[model samples]
Target: MDIQAVDRVGMILALFGPHRESVTSTEAADLIGLNRTTTYRYLNSLVNANVLTLREDRTYVPGPTLVQVGTYAVGRRDVLKVAAEPMQALARETEITAVLSLWGAASPVVAHVEEPPRLEVVVSVRVGMQLSPVAAQTGIFHGFMAGAPSVVRAAREMDDADRERLQSSAHATVRQGYAAQVSSRGIAVLAVPVWDTHGLAASLALLTTRDVLDVETDGPELAALSRTAETISRMLGSTRPAMTG
Candidate 1:
């Protein structure tokens, strides 16, 4: 593939994040560092492949096949089997409540969760429940399929700077298989990517209090979480994205 085509794909993927509406080609060309003609070609290719869709206004948004394939991929018995134990252990270790959420339009669906025995944390979703993708804890997920990157980047719901932050977070999340946040709620989570067979780290995460969020990886609890996350990744036939730092 030409380097120019590669650049266009990056831009298109970049544009899809955050923004909900189909984006104007002209607008996307400007954001992605590509000319209009090349931008449209990439867009059209993605559309044809069902990676993106063109609306009545000729704006491009994510298409159905992307979601369909992603859902179907995760639907495989093997995928769930791989994710189950790490999620349970994460909940037990933190005692702050834990859940495995799949990324979606603007929210996350609770694929699995282990609640505190006595304490109550207002979890936003049920086993299959979905909620916005912007929270501090939710950002620490394993998968990037199913509109995960898009919601983090260009959503109309978040301010431009905030969207960019999510975009950056997604980059690091996709790169390192982990993302962490200390939010206004004082909760902190360390998340890793749960990659698929393609080696695209999907989503893996750790939910804990801000107090223990920065625990060194050498520490027993943090080390255990790391091992558990890696075990899950191995079952998925993958590993965490390489660390750049």
Candidate 2:
């Protein structure tokens, strides 16, 4: 409405940055040269509209509703239902361990994981179990470790330079058709990105554990995973899923 208001909102957005999680009203005011009272007024209005989110401690983050709306607006297509059968088939063939995961904001949750028939080797996961974004052997963290888009957003919690290095590795993970543990007791996972024919859509990945992967230096299994991802993609009507390379 006013010049002062416009300038303050612009400055506040810049401060929000990619990695900084939350900011205080007083801190925003001081940084942007607005009085604390004025800053609180603007922040309160944003919070009420659900444009911004505030914690119990009064710190702020991008609101949940806004995020969901933004993602949908960004044209992300959901492909899980189409991917289920293929995922099950892969698990059935290998009889090792496999999972499908997605980002749940702060962490990764196992959206779907196959139950191993061996009972003992079975790795159980639920609809919503949060995991680290950087762990090499786990859910969404592994997704991020494997370079999933969901994890890429979480990795923005780091500074730009550090984030750049990780993003490079993330891209590599997507291209390589598998993401490997830095060291083992190695838990290697083979993955493939399945996409809708439309370029602007969500992705699905097929995940398999270290055992089946260990038998391979030639990467035939990895290629199979890629093929599986492709099959899933075609089923979803994606004539062109985004290529890794």
Candidate 3:
């Protein structure tokens, strides 16, 4: 294999991150330190191979082949697989609904749910449900995670009071390594972050009635939840230390 060629391809791909979604041949050439003619040749080759798609304006975006390969890679090593056993054990231990939510393009979306065996009352959650920044404790991702698009969207939609409260909650979540909130219907929601090698990969959450579970900063449930989240994070290659309460 040509190591130099592979490294150059990796460099080109690394240019696409966070707010950057597209690149032109000229921009890629300048950023990657290549000559214009050489950059055009490389970009054209990538377009022919479907690794990138060239638009009318000459900007290149990730093509179908790139998207397919990315999706396949995530399917094999995503947080869902690493968190599954820990989430199931947490659900059973807490006797509450355990949820694994991934940070989506705009908000946290439910990726998985585990219900305790033989629970009389179960909180209903479905995969693909978009959790609200105001209504769901998982909004901590928007508040605490850097470069998330949902933060701007949430700030625009909230009033002064709600925004202040969310900011406060987000700060506390960072300090304590978890977020806790209660809904209008007296259901308690507690969430902790599950990190990967990069950063926060997902939120591990528990949902139960206020009577069934007390939401506390240093309570037993919070400790247990944090432990479970840490277990999953370690499995996903996170080296960050756990938050101590």
Q: Scored by CA lDDT, what does every candidate get? A: 0.59, 0.57, 0.78
lDDT digits (tens) for residues 16-123 of candidate 2: 533455899998888778889988998887788787898999897777666777567434535556656777776666664556655454444455666545546554
Separately for all candidates shown, the number of backbone clashes (residues 3 or more apart, or on different chains) is 25, 4, 0
TM-scores for every candidate against the unseen true structure: 0.53, 0.53, 0.66
lDDT (10s digit) by residue, model 3, range 1-245: 38988777876775664346799999999988998898888788889999999999989998899889867865875787778888889888888889888765445767789999987779868776777766555566865584565557656567888777777787778887778888899988988888889887888888888887788646777888889989988998888766746
| Poorest 10 consecutive residues by lDDT, candidate 3 | 146-155
Worst 10 residues of 2 by lDDT: 199-208
Task: Give the clash total for candidate 1.
Answer: 25
Candidate 3 has an lDDT of 0.78
Cα lDDT of model 1 by residue, 1-245, tens digit: 78967755765664454333468888888876778897777788899988888888878887898668756866764657667666676666655455565555445555666665555653323565553456533454422542545553435467778666766666665565456666677666655555567654434455566675673343444555566666776777775433422
Q: After TM-score superposition, what is the CA distance of residue 137 in candidate 3 from its true location, in Å?
A: 3.3
Task: Say what the RMSD of model 2 is.
Answer: 7.2
Off by over 4 Å in 1: 1-77, 93-96, 116-125, 129-133, 136-158, 172-177, 215-219, 239-245
Of candidate 1, the 10-residue stretch with the lowest lDDT total is 137-146
1 or 3, greater by TM-score: 3
Model 3 CA lDDT for position 197: 91
Cα RMSD of all models vs. native, in order, equals 8.3, 7.2, 8.9
